[model samples]
Target: MSLKYAVLAALHEQPATGYDLTRNFRTRMANVWNASHQQIYRELAKMTEEGLLEVEEVPQESRPDRKLYRLSDAGTASLATWLAEPQGRPPTRDPLLVKLFGGDLVDPASLREEIERHRRNWQEELGRYQDIEAEYFSKPEQVPFRFRLQHLALRKGILAMEANLAWADEVAGVLKDELTSRP
Candidate 1:
């Protein structure tokens, strides 16, 4: 999907300043989409001009005014329309996977080390997801109904991390065996 839809969906959650939206993209929406702060700010300006977002200027004592963004009527309709459309699985373009496809060109030991590093990164991400779940979703009944869907999305990220770890373990074992069997 387009960044426009992602921005609209984020604004739908609640009004936020550009900085707030960037923070959410880094943390809460990290699993679903990635966008730079510059890109988000640009989109906010574009959407505001397009009448998809309403901006409120809030003055600050020590800082410049904050432009708080909220989804306008048109934006809500736009988001709803996009949500109703069929979504295909996004194509995977992992850099590590692409590099591995040419693994014969590289030293096996070096490739294995890279794989281990990748595994470690995924492990860290899994911990973050688990922390979010424990902190916010531990008590299902306590969670507001509106947030249950978000919980479900987070679950997908957790499952993906778990699956990646398992796959990494299997591949690392194969690489280790290869290294040992080399005459």
Candidate 2:
């Protein structure tokens, strides 16, 4: 539900530096959750202070010291507690949906273009999910047990994106017909 839970879940996978977590957000959490580098680094510090994360500093020869983090027992407990609480899927508040609802006020053609743009973005996201699934999940035997757990979440994203793109197409068609039929 909270960013803290996501962070804990990630750290539970393996010990990682703040940079590593950020990279994971870009690739692994791209569909699920995305946090900026700054946000992640800040959360790491906060979690460390809260005793939910264990940090180990490793000296580097050329660069500054790196701090690797792992979930503490408290963090693990926290995550489990949160998980047991049956929270449904996250809600999305897209401004485009609002605009679409009142699209008659604007130029129909422009509104249709906006819907098309949103559809294109979702199409791109679906492609990314498909690519990741193919690259990492196709060979399930090679992946770790934890990765097998992730397959469902990844599949959920792929399905949601697909259904959304289909909905977008349907709405766009309606827009075209409605506009064209206007007296």
Candidate 3:
């Protein structure tokens, strides 16, 4: 999905400044979609020009004025249409899988190190997912539908990480066996 749609979806819940949107993306949307602050700011500008989003300047005494963005009627309609469309297959681009496919030509020590690193990353990701889950459980009633979508994404991420960690451990075991049996 395009950043425009993501931005529109975020604004659908409530109006927010660009900075607020950025924080929302990082904390709540990071599992499903990622966007840099610059990208979000640029998309907000484009959406404003396209009449999909409306921006209001909120004056501040001690800081720069904030431009709060809200979804226009066009933006809401666009988001509804996009959400109604069927999702296509996601493109796969796993760098670790590419490296593993070329394992026969790789140095055994280096491959083992890479696998260990992947295991660590998965562990960290699992922790993040667990945190999200915990937060959801803490306030079931307050959880929004969009946040529910994010929770599902986090569940998928958690499972993916578990599978990766299992695969890495198995590969490491095989590599160890090969090294020990080398004649």
Candidate 4:
């Protein structure tokens, strides 16, 4: 629901430094929620002050000390409570979709170009999700029961990317045959 909850979910997995959380966000969590490094670090500070996280500073010889954050029991309770509550679909705000709503007035060629770009992006995203799935979820038998939910979330991402690519293909085909062929 909030950045605070995302941070709590990350730390719920394991204790990690802010940098570690940022890396996780880039690699896997980005599928669910995207946050810049600065946003993450700032949220971590706020969470720390809110008593949702406990930080342990580990000093390094040549490098700066790293603050490893762990979820407090209160945070754990909060996370569990939040998970139990239902989440509503977020209000849509996709500019491309909004523009596509006016298909009769819009130029077909331009719309096709935009769809092509979106298809390319979805393809790239699918590749990344597939790589993660193969690397981690391939051998579900080997995974502990605790990680099943994580795999489930990853599956959702892969499916979403696949669906988006499929829709893009259909839209492009329609534009080429019907829309673009007209005056």
Cα deviation of 109, candidate 4, in Å: 1.0
Q: Please give the range of 10 consecutive residues that has the lowest summed lDDT in model 1.
A: 139-148
- Candidate 1 stretches with Cα past 4 Å from truth are none
Which digits, one per residue and each the tens of the lDDT, describe model 1 over residues 44-157?
A: 999999999998999999989988999999999989999999999989889999887889787789989999998999999999888888877898677787688888888999
Q: Write the per-residue lDDT of candidate 2 for residues 9-97, one digit (tens) a residue.
A: 89888999999999988887787787999999999989999999998999999999999999999989988899899788668898988
Ranking by TM-score: 1, 4, 2, 3
Clashing pairs in 1: none
Candidate 2 clashing pairs, residues 3+ apart or interchain: none
Q: Is candidate 3 or candidate 4 better by TM-score?
A: 4
The reply for model 2, stretches above 4 Å from the true place, is 88-92, 141-145
Candidate 1 local accuracy as lDDT? 0.90
Q: What TM-score, computed on C-alpha atoms, does each candidate reach?
A: 0.95, 0.91, 0.89, 0.94
Per residue, candidate 4 scores C-alpha lDDT tens digits across 86-133 of 999889899988878997587888899999999999999999988988
For model 3, the stretches where C-alpha displacement exceeds 4 angstroms are 139-146
Comparing 2 and 4 on TM-score, the stronger one: 4
The digit string of per-residue lDDT tens for model 3 on 148-179 reads 66667777877878888898889999888877
